[model samples]
Target: MNDTSEKSSPRPRATILGGGPAGLMAAERLARLADVHVFDSMPSFGRKFLLAGKSGLNITHGEQLEAFLARFGEARTLLEPALRAFPPNAIRDWAEALGIETFEGSSGRIFPVAMKASPLLRAWLARLRESGVSFHARHEWQGWTEDGALRFGTPDGEATFTADVTVLALGGASWPRLGADGSWTPFLSARGVETAPFRPANCGFDIQWSEHLLDRFAGSPLKSISLSFCGRTVKGDFVVTKTGIEGSAVYALSAALRDSLEAGANTVLMLDLAPDRTLSQLASALSAPRGKTSLANHLRKKAGIDGVKAALLREIAGKALLDDPAKLAHAIKNLPLRLDRPRPIAEAISVAGGIALSELDESFMLKKCAGVFAAGEMLDWEAPTGGYLLSACLATGRAAGEGAARWLRRS
Candidate 1:
């Protein structure tokens, strides 16, 4: 018994596909008890992560669990375990361990002091390297060889590798330029995995616009506005893009809009240009809007609206409505814009539909592919941005790593 207690640690061997935050986290967790290798198609890893962090990392939110949990929508039940295992607080702590002090904004969205992704990625990658994990960059996964070996098309040429366990952290079909091109679906489907059709999740919708409005207002931002569609209302800024309105606010509501379009009714986004003013109060104030003054001037000066906001009002209710102050005020409060269709998956921030939940075990391992597992956006779940994308990535990566270890241990 004493001799057995002195035995050395058992080192499992694992091969992880993809090298984003999820892949790296898996590699890090596995390296502690296993030999880990991370393969990525991109020239360098974390391109999408870095892109997400370009403005600010928005690592996570500090809101109460109830509110934070609500943001996951239909994904709550599926993501509960992984998220519970490593929640937002855990992410903040992990970042803090890397010397990235995070602070919460008034809205509860958390961000690092430096507010850039590069630094945090640098620290995380350093930790993984220090943990003795190997990284194979520019290595594209091309399904598995007939004999069960992992196949990849590298700069050197096609090559195959095998491991006791394999973790697939391959990202979704968004931002193909960043390398998550969704080319792995067919391969997985061929192996009898019940994969879903990938589509845009947190993306924008196309709104047919008159050429005049498109040309004049395109790219203009309407600040401090609230957009409400269906039962949801998102308060933030939005840009009048040539194709439609887009921004954090619009993208946040894309799933609802996209779903509506699919269900047949054209979805409408009602933009509250002045949510602060009630329609009745606005009507009263506008009942006598600068009598002789032009409507545009009155709208710009009295209502504090001009440019795209004014154009948006006219775009919704029209010039006749604009001339009538009471009508104009009501229109300002409820400027309805029709959404035609969702932007393609290539333009989305994340994707919906993937390896369906029914096809995977609790550990995210594909039931059909015994030694194979999936994590991150590759699985069938989607949440809006604001650090959720990265958080799930880390959480699922860690879960898959733990799962791979367990699988190998059992094998």
Candidate 2:
């Protein structure tokens, strides 16, 4: 016998700045109840995501939680809760719901079946639109106004807006051309929110390569090699760039190397030219060298070290050691190449050092600035490639979205 209709009222507005994966995910979650709006500096959204998928869209890793969690390093503890709640399985499921089928590669890195981000992004945008979410492109966030309103510079002119809650998914300082330029750092810092200086991550380091080696092997790939630094070893292929070495293996240890350089310490990357052969085995093989064969030929035939690998060894161990089998074998097994400095942040894949974790609550909302949440590379956490970065971004975005909804409901 109770017939009562709820009073009509304006829905709470949730604004998500930066239309990357993190911002998009937050908008998706918040659109259920709030008037969600996603703003981006780019012409459209997900430019970096598309670029990442140019090779293949490594969505997430299919490894066990323990191993996958360990990849976050010092931020592992801070990120475990978000990741555990929405782990690899959750990511695959979310993609599937968007009609984007994904599969695990041989390396256990997950990717969409199409292996491109365009289809997935198109489908995602459609879904967000259907969910009552709005998009504003080329509206570059220019920090906040004196009255605490979100300010953006648009093609037409400067615009301002106020939202019940805001989720900042502005990415780090990598790929500035793609829109994540780390311009939001000062905004939070000015509000007494602590932040770490953005630094390169998963990037190349400069080395003193002789002009000869640089010219010959600058673009060559050093395949099936092992690189170790700071007690961490990664077995993968890397390319010899004109400045230094870079690729999967080098990037895996980029954080440690970049940190070392920041601390003003000399850093060395040890490359095992022939990882398959033991040091003793290499010595024994070299000891039985030909009587008149050329040193390069002898190396290629006996130890399978030639081309760029041989050049790298000579670059580090010198030609005199090539005559000494024992020393040459040791050098081949542990060729130490000192790294000068990390490539500029513009060239990094992602970046470390952002809004410090201490500044945000467990829900990813800034404690000092209530109703303001942050996610993605804007936060001070870095993980190597192979999908760790994207997973954390998605998880934290979801957390912020759910938190924003709750905060708005309470208000």
| Candidate 2 segments exceeding 4 Å error | 1-9
Candidate 1 local lDDT, 190-309, one digit each (tens): 988988888898888888888989989899998999999888898998888889877899888888888889899968888899988788877777776386888777777777789988
lDDT of 2 by residue, 295-398 (tens): 99999988999999999888888888999989989999899989999999999999998999998888889999999999988999999999998999999998
The clash numbers for all candidates, in the given order, read 0, 0
Error of 1 at 169 (Å): 0.4
lDDT of 1 at 140: 91
Which runs in model 1 stand beyond 4 Å of their true positions?
Answer: 1-10, 289-291
Highest TM-score, which number? Answer: 2
Clashing residue pairs found in predicted model 1? none
How does residue 66 of candidate 1 score in lDDT?
73
lDDT of each: 0.84, 0.90
